[model samples]
Target: MNTRQSRLDVLHSLRERETRSGYGWALSTDVPPGLQQSLQTAAAQGLVELADREIRAELSAHEGRPVLWAARLSPQGHDVLTYLDASPDPTPNCTPPSADEQVIELRPAQMDALRVYANLGPVLRVAPADGLVERVRTAYFDRPGNRWRMTLTTEQIDSVAYAFYLRALSGSVAEANWFARKYGVTYRVDPATGRPGAVRPRARTVSP
Candidate 1:
């Protein structure tokens, strides 16, 4: 199995537990000592949170050895998992978006229409035939680059996804709908004009 895939699986299992039972999910349930040992590694990497008692006990026993994980994922871990959920195994092909909280994939039509968006002439410099998807996976994640990709966080998507949608609308309804479906962008019908316009992002965060 892939290295990160196992860890992601382990973490996903933990997340499922958290999803089902909140944070009180038991960490001592795994039968294999190796699996338990893997937990320490996850904790040491800060992907999961472990109790102080476990930490103290492990340190005293191993004295700088690999730490075992038994807790749920941290906020950063959760965000990372969402941002990195791409195809063909657990290998993440996209770089984490810069200074942001999400990364949304862009459809081809939106990519075309977004080029004509207002004042973007000086923004997107490299209109690669593939639209920087390869480069984004391996290199840059600047504001313009991310926006050009439509790979944005919730706030950025809320504001920019709409403009691109409108721009696409002028080109093709199919393209506009494709973009809207990607982010589930919603509209409020204007009271007087009764036209569906503007954009609203579905809540991606919730308070516990």
Candidate 2:
């Protein structure tokens, strides 16, 4: 069977015997001997963890173990369960872009603001102007490069807005305005009386 089928089979077995046994399956049997291998695969994939490795058998723990048995969630296991539980649904209508989408280049000042907001580590060295934005854009799009790029989500933006008034603060208004314009988001402020005008760019359409 394929990996998906094997995983489903293993999960099914675990779900079935969850309440009846000594911390799930003790060992695999003729009824389904490949369960051990499936568990190992799940452990490798982060869905489970090797809770214990005794001379007799290896034990695996799932998410419920933490809540039901007061077990601790290992960092790796926690990341895996979070991914599995919160993964976005895939739909036929959603498709990845075939070619690079046109991206607005970040100005030097804007790049500095992004770095500050995103808490990027010390700038190693600035790239030349000609290829800087393209490189930055690629880093922004790549999940593994999240450390360097401004990966602010909508919710995070809202939180930041509540925490501080960027426009009212010294030396921050321009950068704040630039970011607000780029994302087409407006901070909560009096439209008629605010120092920084509430005007923002039209929201850009994005593809999945």
Candidate 3:
């Protein structure tokens, strides 16, 4: 299972336990010993939060070092886990839509449409052609309005296009849009409003 899934299982296990439960032993017993380390890492990453201060103290006492055990999910972590749980798997092993299918080259207008769709959520997949696999990527929701955004260098355009082609092969239009919005390097004008369209990074521009 993926890291998020493993962390989710750990969180569920923790939630099932009674309050005041010990941390170290509970973690070793509940999750695989190998995964215990991952759990700790997850905690450090703020993906999971411990319930009580006493548990941290106990862990520290046992380890004879200062230990921090607040595994509560941060808002971003929660969003990631929630998205992972909800999104359909878009790996390459999944069957493609069809053989002998033509690759869809995204137009500037289509790319803009994709950006509008992707700003709504964090997880998106895109497929653009046959003989290619789905490309899956995560987006960070920007502050304030929570706009989904991703940065890619111009050289990465082919990689991004491959991803979009894969999503298109999977017949996931929404996922395709997300991939386009996150990676498309072209722009288009809105015919109705006559406003500046989604910003497309130039191939010569390098993301810092």
Best candidate (score: TM-score):
1
lDDT of 1 by residue, 166-193 (tens): 5554655665576567657643454656
The TM-scores of all predictions, comma-separated, are 0.35, 0.33, 0.32
RMSD of each: 17.1, 13.7, 15.4
lDDT of 3 by residue, 79-113 (tens): 76577666634332323424422223344434444
Candidate 2: tens digits of C-alpha lDDT, residues 1-208: 9977566555555545443444543333322445656666766766554444441232323323222111122356455445655543322112332343223334555555543434422342421223333333334322343233322334444433322234236446765555556655555555666654334345689999
Clashes of 2: 0
Candidate 1 segments exceeding 4 Å error: 30-32, 54-69, 85-208
RMSD of 2: 13.7
lDDT of each: 0.54, 0.42, 0.46
